[model samples]
Target chain A: MRHARIIFDGRELDIDIDANDRITTSEGEVLDVALDSDQITWLPPVKEPGTIFALGINYADHATELAFEPPKEPLIFIKHANTLTGHKQVSYRPDGIEYQHYECELVAVIGKSGKNIKREDALDYVAGYTVCNDFAIRDYLENYYRPNLRVKSRDSLLPMGPWIVDTADIPNANALKLTTTVNGKLTQDGSTKDMIFDVPFVIEYLSKVMTLNPGDMICTGTPHGIVDCQPGDTIVCTIEDICSLETRMVSEQEYYGDKY
Target chain B: MTANTLVNSKLVCVALNDKAQLAALDATFNEAPYKKPPTQPVLYYKPRNTWSVDGAEVEWAKDFDGNDVAEMVVGASLGVVIGKETCRVSAEDALNYVAGYTIVGDFSLPEASYYRPDIKGKCLDTSAPVGPEIVAADKIANPDALTVTISVNGELKSTFELGNMERSVAELISIISRIMTLQAGEIIAVGFAGDRVAVAKGDKVEASIEGVGTLTNTLGGA
Candidate 1:
């Protein structure tokens, strides 16, 4: 079963998507509207997301590509809730900035609250999986909190959802293929199997220091093949059996107009 | 305790906002990794799991020997609470978006380097204790002129002036809002100085800002 939150006809709804891609209410009343219709606006699958944890270099190949060694422990960072936008949202590409890249990642949404969770029991805490495009502007990167919020947590930078696929459906979340495309051309291709710290280890590691609450999302880091994005580019990040999250990059001027 | 309900969103904190902290690391600014001093506000987030109310008992982190880490740094700071959705406002108008002020105790295990985000040392559960009560923004004449003091078991450990910050409360809001929108009920902790005090397990820690309430918490054995 896949679940989603959306705004249809100016009404926010908690919907479920059937295997045939039909939208239905929680009570199973099928809606006549299609997801791509103008009347519907997709929101992040999680209605009210809790803490958003992101891995910086979870993939060994990605670490090597960036000229860094694999970390001994998970290198995690937090993103504010305001950074999130839904599928088909527009993320701003700052004017005259160089090297703004998209990171396609698989996100694990926590369903249960627990501390000191063991690796073997971590899966029980996950509600489902989704996809996110963790876009970063490398030009703003600084060593003081490398990958600072300015570079990563800008508004609408993280485009997530479409919907969340249940944990039971994935069977092996670590073996899935993750891909990213720019204007319908494949730009990144990788597998979750390359993650130095898998989902269970990440969950266990984080829960050791703090409680993992429901709606807390862990964006498992992206793979290597990153290409700088442009104003008119549409980037789609997809995870097998989960979601294909789409985002359109627009100029800072276009996004804010004369407001800024 | 009721003040915790006011903070339903993220706690964004600025690093090295203190002139003293920046001065202490002035020589290293030209070094590798950081070729220049921060040109922009260095920001990080304290996740919801780290949020605890005033007077709460926070567990101390344990060492490899299963014993408690000797001490943790006390980051006494003034928290600016936002009243509305604020974005790209000027410093002159930033105060209008502020709702109130509170005391925040950003406790963390002491670390030597500031090159990376100290997730393990700073983001432990109950590491950030906010509030006794919020003092309405209008009630405080000058937040930057306030003095912040830290006490351990009723003993004065450290005292610093908020005026030492490189960025004022309004400027931080103005600058940060240029990149991200600060939602209502969220907090932005105006940074603490390098002269941080340390407290050990079983010690009662209190951080108070002039014109704002005091936030008290005790470090408990893990």
Candidate 2:
């Protein structure tokens, strides 16, 4: 099942999407809405996600490219609510900064709450998967508190979800193909298999520390092929059949740089 | 709303934001991974599971390895509760966004380094014990000048003033709001100064902030 949260008739509602890509109300009433309907707006599929737990260097190739050794344990960081943006939104790249990039990742949405969950029981806790473009402004990077808020938690930096594909439909998650395209050019291409830490283990590791609550999103780290992205550049991220999240980059001036 | 009916909101903790505390961490973990004193707010989330009210029992969650429950480091802190939608708020106007204040017993397991946060060490369920009451922001004459003290099993451990914080309430709110909109009811746990003592199971812990009120919790489970 694919669920998309959208604004229709001036009110936010969760609509069901058929396998044929048709949108309908949860009550099965057909909605005359398209994913690109100008009359409607998009909201993140998982609204009010408590905390977005993101991984750093979870892909070996990306790790080697950054000249860092693979960490034995997950390098996790928190991305607060302010960073979340829905599909078709614009992420801001501040002026005079260099090396801002888009990272295509698979995000796991937790359904049930559990703590100290076993690795084998991990998948059962996952409600579904969605696509995330964890945009970063690398110019703010400091070795101190690596992957700090300045780098990862900028407003609108994280664009996630058109819909969340139920876990039951994605039985072989490790085999799913993930990719990112910039203005129609393929940039990041990889598979879930390339993850240094796979989904279940990641959940198991997280649950060992904090209780995974419903609506919490665990953004599995991004893959390699990170390149600079700029204003007006449209980026689309996909996790095979799970979902596709498209976002555009706009300069701070274009958004709010001039306001202050 | 009465105290029993008030909803528990998100808890955001400022990490290593005290000048003396950061210097201590800088001296101890002097290595390539970390730069001396973070230039930005190093923050962590203590999710809702960690939220417990005053006088509650903070369970020592059975460790993952099934070993004896590890001792917890009880960090006492002052929390600024947001009362309004704050977005890109200026430091000069940050205090107006605060609705009230409370005392928080920010508990965690000991970790060696601050480079990467250990979820196991900091985010366990029932780890953060907050409040006896939320003193309205305006009621407190000077939020920055108050003293916070901690005691374990009725013995005083440490006491520190909130004025020692490297970043004031307005500055933290201003910097954080620039990154993300801080909604009403959410809390920002200001960094703790002085020392955090290792508390064992069966020990009673009490954290008190002058004017805000005291939060007491007993560690449970062997």
Candidate 3:
């Protein structure tokens, strides 16, 4: 069955969805739960995922455009849980950075837990899938700083969700379209096919090191064409079968003000 | 005394006082829970200077020395400790690398970080006070199911579940190990779920978890 968490009118429910992961609830049903839009908090569909990892400089096209060769292996980084925000959330603008951008990519959600799974059965471990925008504070790209607390893990930096789709629904997660729009303008237009290493490879590569939990999320690298944005920009990122994540670019003052 | 425990469950305890307040949180893993270790295992540092126990009493002052101030952190989460030597471990293999979890209070003026540009915004002596006790890893079944709430002087500031986090403890360990080496006694704090709030002097902060225990600290004035 299609699964979704939606806030309609003033109710929230884990309802069945179509391919879009949207609310399939018929009107006037009065969702079993009600929450103010402002008060409603959305979580990534996968339960307590073990990790939130990302691939760095993974797309060969992105690698070539920047004049850098792709790493011999996947270059991974962590975006602390503090950086996560679901659809219709706000992503903070760092205090000192002038540049920031959104990278849309397919997020592989692990289903079963196993280590050293062969590439042939890698797809067997995938539970479902979701979408995540690696909302980055691109300010430190020039500086040689650790991605730990700097490049990533800023306040509410990642915008994920709408929902998680069973991996089976996506015949080829690697062949989907990943797009990003900011302030209603096209900012990033890319494809998973351009990935130097596809999802199965990522899973096979990652499993050798750690056992991915059912809810854990891994972002396949974003493709080329990343555009910069500032506060007051609204970004909407969508992956083909997965859901879309919408967020507002907020400044420090706005983030720390009445909202915080 | 030996106790029965599960492999996927990791229990990290922090002890630092007469009445050590303990909290149990999950670590990602030592090995590549997802892929493989990036390179030389990293035993990152988040000294006691950066430690902050949730549910500890916090007080306000202009600065640690006395300046103009707005508010202070009450029952809250401040920082996390990264283990030094763990490698390619999974959520199931997490329990062994823990030193334990502790309860501490952190009070650093935003300016305190400016004084020392070398380190990040954290790392101040007394910046962290941990422990009420250490809970064995096997003791807690699901870290995600546990409740983490912060109260400032009897008022509830935030209430969230470890499950609320985007990433779980096991996954964090797996992912972290992939990037850097994790050593025994290292810790990774699953970030808090809500925004932090301030508490005044004489306030009491309490942090509690199901199956684990509670930690209480009085605002001593920062």
Q: Which candidate number has the best lDDT?
A: 1
- Candidate 1 pairs with clashing backbones: none
- What ranking of all candidate models by TM-score puts the best one first? 1, 2, 3
Could you tell me the TM-score of candidate 1?
Answer: 0.96
Relative to the real complex, the DockQ score for model 3 comes to 0.03
Q: lDDT by residue for model 2 over A1-260, one digit each (tens)?
A: 79878888897888888787788887778887677787767888886577688989999989988888988988888776678888888888878898999888889899998877888989999999988888888888866457777788777898888888898999888888989899999998999888899889988888876778888888889878899998999999988988788898998867665443
lDDT of 3 by residue, B146-196 (tens): 666777667777775655555555656665553334444445545444344
Q: How accurate is candidate 3 locally (lDDT)?
A: 0.56
Best by DockQ: 1
Per-residue lDDT of B1-222 in model 2, one digit per residue for the tens? 113412244577887767788666765556656645577887777766677788888877667786656566888888888999887889999999999999878788776666775667777777887788788998987788888899988899988777888888889999988776688888888888636788998889989887788889998874
Better of 1 and 3 by DockQ: 1
Q: Which segments of candidate 2 are over 4 A away from where they belong?
A: A257-260, B1-9, B26-30
Write the candidate numbers in order of decreasing lDDT.
1, 2, 3
Superposed Cα deviation of residue B131, candidate 2 (Å): 1.0
Count of backbone clashes for each model? 0, 0, 61
- TM-score of each model, paired residue for residue: 0.96, 0.94, 0.54
Model 3 vs. true fold: TM: 0.54
TM-score of chain B, candidate 3? Answer: 0.60
Tally clashes: model 3: 61
